[model samples]
Target: MLRQVQKQMSLHSILYNKISENHILKKINYVVDFSFINKLLEDSYCKNFGRPAKEPEMMCKLLFLQHLYILSDEKVIEEANLNLGYMYFLGINPEDELPDKSLLSKFRTQRLEEATLDEIITEIVRQCVEKGIIGGTSVSVDATHIEANTIRKTPERLMKHLARKIIKTYEKENNQVLEEIPEVPKYKEIEDHTEAKAVMKDYLENVISKVKKNIRKDCSESIKTKETIEKAREIIEDPKFLNQKGVRSIIDEDARVGRKSKNQEFYGYKTEFMMTADERIITSVRTADGAYVDGTYADELIEQTLKSGMKIEEVYGDKAYFRKPILNSIEEIKAKAYIPVSESVYRIDESEFSYNKDSDEWECREGNITVKKKYYKIKGKSRPDREGYKYYFEPEQCKRCPKHDECAKKSARKILQIGLNTIEFYEISQYQKTEEYLEKYKKRASIEGKNAELKRFHGLYRARGYGLLSVSMQSKLAAIAVNIKRIAAIAASKFCIFTLNIKIFSQYYKFCLN
Candidate 1:
């Protein structure tokens, strides 16, 4: 009976109205990337009421597709509406009332405020879970510098820089000749600073040839350059005290000059994020002032993601997040923080915590005493400034110790900042020996790939908005778009799998007849 019912099933049966090929073609033809647009509309809410309440679902889809394709409002209305593929994917028609860019912008703003920018990201994440797009494995936590639209150098900043150079230039040359004073840009900010070092050099050269002897001594030309750039950097940092006369950067408070992991330096804001390995799903992200340190933000972010209900298993970060204090934090969360050992903690001696040939406990570096195992509550004791805690061999015991110089301090006790069960310490420690930790730990690098996708694939390198808020908003949107793409990819994969299963079943039926 069951087999007969299965055989009677009609493949052509429709779940809803039979969407005509003409209707599909018209909707999709005028559109941009059909698949991405389709993904943007995958959510039921987006499919149902994405457009105005009075507007048809098809029209709403076209507007959203326009947003996904990044077509200007005018372009989306005139060009996209005419294409069949775009129309079909949008579930809209050429005859339907098309939305202008303003309309699109308004809806985005509304949704952004209502659902919030992270809603799309949340949706994408949900899809990833449902489709088995990600493994609850290790994720990489890192940050990238996003260039701000502010000026690094200002005319006022330049004049302050140049005045010192002028004095130094005159002193170094011995006042050999006279030359015209150069105009200084006192307010040039950041990348917009017009005067390069070469121009600065030229100005000094002129001043040197003119008043070489009149200038004072005790400072070299290099000293002058150093002073000028230093003062300029200071001025750039504090915008409230602009001394020069020129336009200021639109953003100053949150923008900072920071270095990336690759050693490339830029003056901008920072974007910290976490990404899973399987599909590179960004689990969490933060936009911070450029002065923000990746190391400083890790612990807080760990807490936040946990609060968000993301079932974290382990976290991976570069040397930056190898905070020793975070180890206990990992334990508290029932998760792990996988940060690498920092070079700053190199002076530590682990011999005491080394493999005690018999007990298998890690010994301290000082091979002095037979045993010195003591655990103290972390709250009352001051945590040393190192990545791990500073524990030591008994100082009195170290006074006459043989490995004193190598392991113990003469006046100080042998202390090591033992990392709290953080995943970073786990890498070199005995933790990775476990299959579960190793499996999750290997996936941390995936976040770096996610960063690359955001910048290279999504065009999020330089934020388009003026203030940090705008930049943050744009960054979140890019994340949302990436999430949308992931959802679409999952949906497409499911569709493909469904088609394959049907094909296999048909083949089985043919064989049975034979």
Candidate 2:
């Protein structure tokens, strides 16, 4: 059951009203209405039965303050209990009781879902759109890395730790120590990592096999024992387990090894978002493992922004978003993409050959037209030039050409792999020299500042807890807090106050001086 919390008169609230009326929280409270939170998350609670729970709006407001000031769960409650402005913002009297810190964590992990968090952002952006805060049709997309909370371990050490955990669990469940356990591998004695990994793997497999044979068949197994055995088996069966780093941590398995640059790597997750070009308000956000690509969520971000009633006319990003599918998706919505072209992916020499658009073939300087074409999909893990076409000329034509010695010296025929979007990319590369593209591309720099703000002030530089869910909630709530702050500034500048209704504002402000 949802408990409806109503503000009542109190001597402490009366004494502190005058000093807090001019506070920023008071203006924020006047500009934004948190009542939508309860209604948005109304389905999360039991409406007919059960004891009354803390007001969903109040709990969410607590979260807003937590991320707004970058305070921990326990620290935010202690600060809220002491600060009158926080109480006023939360719509609680000075003497009212607050929930414990554990409840805040529970509310974050259990009561809230990722979809609800996205809805909260959408609703806030919707308010901004209604208030004329976000009026531009241009949006910028970018991503940043967040470090994981667990300590990273090497392959040998990780395998040893997992094996020890299983052995300990089996011993605890069966209440008897194995007399003939496998001896620990002397990893230091081996100089080769591959040999050391193989030895450690063999030792772990022996431990697992020995434990399975000793289990009593007449009784059911404990959940912990079964899970540990399954995990060991899964790790053993993975062909690429030793080839990649940071796949399965003893603590956080969801995190992976991602790159900040070619020379730099990080063990954690990535947060990608879309923000309005003019107002700098984040419209949508997505979280993935550290190795996630930058522009994988462009379509979803643009769709979310459109759903919030904002028209998107132009999209801007770095070279990572210059894929054919992403460009086609943006073009489908009648929006132009201003991403820079990656020279490595779109480089082609146009002096020797010309493309025939009507025939979909290329002609060389010697009048040798392409006789055959096949779609060549790049195999393996490399992403550069993934999909393209290999244009092949007639063998006799190539062998008879004067330039055959230079173009096809060692091959039977001359073959050229042209990028799928080479022509469109060439046009975009030409457009990059114009004034319009230069001026609009300047806006992309703002997202970098926004990323720095998220990392420096809002505690998004590192994960507060393990897993993707907790970090995602942290990121979206930070966005909401910043949006509220931005709305307050815009409202004060325009001398316009925004709220759901005048009645709710008056009820909260009746005791304060004008």
Estimate the overall C-alpha local distance difference test score of candidate 2. 0.83
Task: Mark the 10 consecutive residues where model 1 has the least summed lDDT.
Answer: 1-10
Candidate 1 C-alpha error for residue 302, in Å = 6.4
Q: Which candidate is the best by lDDT?
A: 2
Task: Residues 257-279, candidate 2: write the lDDT tens digits.
Answer: 88999999998999999998778
TM-score of each: 0.59, 0.85
Give the runs in model 1 whose Cα sits over 4 Å from its true position.
1-79, 89-91, 103-111, 127-140, 158-248, 251-253, 295-310, 324-333, 343-367, 370-428, 433-440
Residues 143-260, candidate 1, lDDT per residue (tens digit)?
A: 8878877666643444344455545544455444333555553333434434443354355445444433333342334455445445444544444433332223423545656666
lDDT values for all models:
0.54, 0.83
Q: Show model 2 residue runs off by greater than 4 Å.
A: 9-12, 19-22, 216-220, 349-416, 496-514
